[model samples]
Structures are given as structure tokens and as C-alpha cells.
Target: MMENVVIRTVSRLAVPFIQIFALYVIVHGASGAGGGFQGGVVFAASFILMIIAFGTANVRRRIDNRGIMWLSVIGITIYAGIGFLALLMAGNFLEYAAIEAVLGIPHLHGILIDLVEAGIGIAVMAAMVSIIYDISGNGEESS
Candidate 1:
């Protein structure tokens, strides 16, 4: 963990902005450049930043292994649920348009696409954080 006050303060302040930017990247991906995978890496970057500034144990208090696994599960469920829903509606998996067709809701296609991206972002972020935590070792403060 970083002991420098300046670095710790700066990182603390920057984490929120980093997360917002990641969300922007994910949302904007629906229309133009950037997407789930990219945004996910960005989101995970914030947690990585936290680990650098605050250390694993500190971050873990906020989000532990169980929480990470739950996040992964929720994200995967969102993605797969949408795909299966489409399939049940007589369309190929992940066919966002089929949902719109069946529900007759205009503009649902874009929404569904965005949802899938959100799920991807969540899952990716969780996975990345999990890996980093594991690789960072047992969070013991080395003298």
C-alpha cells in the first residue's frame, strides 16, 4: 500500500471520476466507439487503482470475494437471461430485436444492447478485480 498521503488522497479522489468515465465509455459504446469489454477494463482499473493506493485488505473490506462472485453471477445472469429470452421468443440467442418485436416496444432494441454491454462491463470488472486480489497475495502489510 502506498504510504504517501498525497498519493493516497489523489487516488481516493480519482476513483469516482474513473468509474464515471468507465460508465460513459460503456454507455457511449452503444452508439459509437468503445464498448463493454473496453469499458469493463476501465471500470476494473479503478479497483486496481484502489489496490495501489489503499491496499487489498482495505478494498476487500468494501468488496470481498463473495461480493465479487455475486457480481460475476449477476452479470452473467443478465447476459444469459436476455439471450435465452430471445431464444424463447423464436429468435436466435441475444437477438435484441426479437424482444422488441414480441413486446412491440419501440427502441427496446437499443436498450437491450446497452443492457448486455452493462452486464459485460460488470462481469469483466469483477473478474479483473478478483484476479488482481488473488495475485496481490494475502494482503499482509510487509515491513
Candidate 2:
């Protein structure tokens, strides 16, 4: 638990940039070489960096166990909800075209894809962080 000023300051400065880049990857998923998995892994890497620099205890204090569970649930729900919405619209699962027609949006398909990517990112990030926390004995469920 030794605190080094230089290390701490550098980590503090770098974390925000890491997060921003992760978001950039998620948003630019449609344009080029980026998507939910890459962005999510990058986001999780930021937390991993925090765990290394600060400690698992600090990371857990920031996000907590219940928060992770809710994040996972919300993410998958958003994903499935979109699929179900398509079904309700009388289309097969994940048929974004149906969503576009029903909602009458010109570019709704791409936007919905982006939304799904975001959900996947959130879920992956939570899962990765939870896995790290558990492996390091920081998870609440750990005895």
C-alpha cells in the first residue's frame, strides 16, 4: 500500500485518456476497425491498470459488486430488447430493418447497431472487471 506520487499522478492523468479512447473505439465501430469487443476490452484494460497502480480494493470501492451485476444485466437486456423489438414488429430477431420501418427513421438501423455495440461493450467491460476482481480475491462473493 505504498503510495508513490509520480506513479499515482501518472495513472490519474492516463485513466481519463484511456477511457476516452475506449469510447472512441466503440463509437467508431461502424466506420472502420473497431467494435464492441475491442472497445470493451480496452475499457476493461483501463480498470486493470487502476488495479495495478492503486489496488483491487480501490477499484472495488469505485464500482462495487452490485453495480457490476446491474451493468451486465442492463447491457444484455438492451441487446435482447432490441432483438425482441424486432420480433414484436413481426420480423426475425435482430432485424434492424423492421425497426427502421416501424420507427420511420432513415438511418435507424445503423443507430440501433451502435446502441447494441454499446450494450455489448458495457457487458464485456463488467464481465472482465468482475473476473479480475474475483481472481484477485476482491469480489464480494468470494469467501
Index of the highest-TM-score prediction: 1
| TM-score versus the correct structure, for each prediction | 0.94, 0.93
RMSD of each: 3.0, 1.7
Q: For model 1, how does the per-residue alpha-carbon lDDT over 12-131 read when each residue is reduced to its tens digit?
A: 899999999999999999899999889999999999998989888889889888899999999889889999999999999999888899999999989999999999999999999888
Name the regions of candidate 2 deviating beyond 4 angstroms.
138-143
Q: List candidate 1 stretches off by more than 4 Å.
A: 139-143
lDDT of 2 by residue, 10-120 (tens): 888999999999999998998899998899999999998888889888888889888998999998998899999999998899999998899898999999999999999
RMSD of 2: 1.7
**Per-candidate count of clashing residue pairs (backbone under 3 Å):** 0, 0
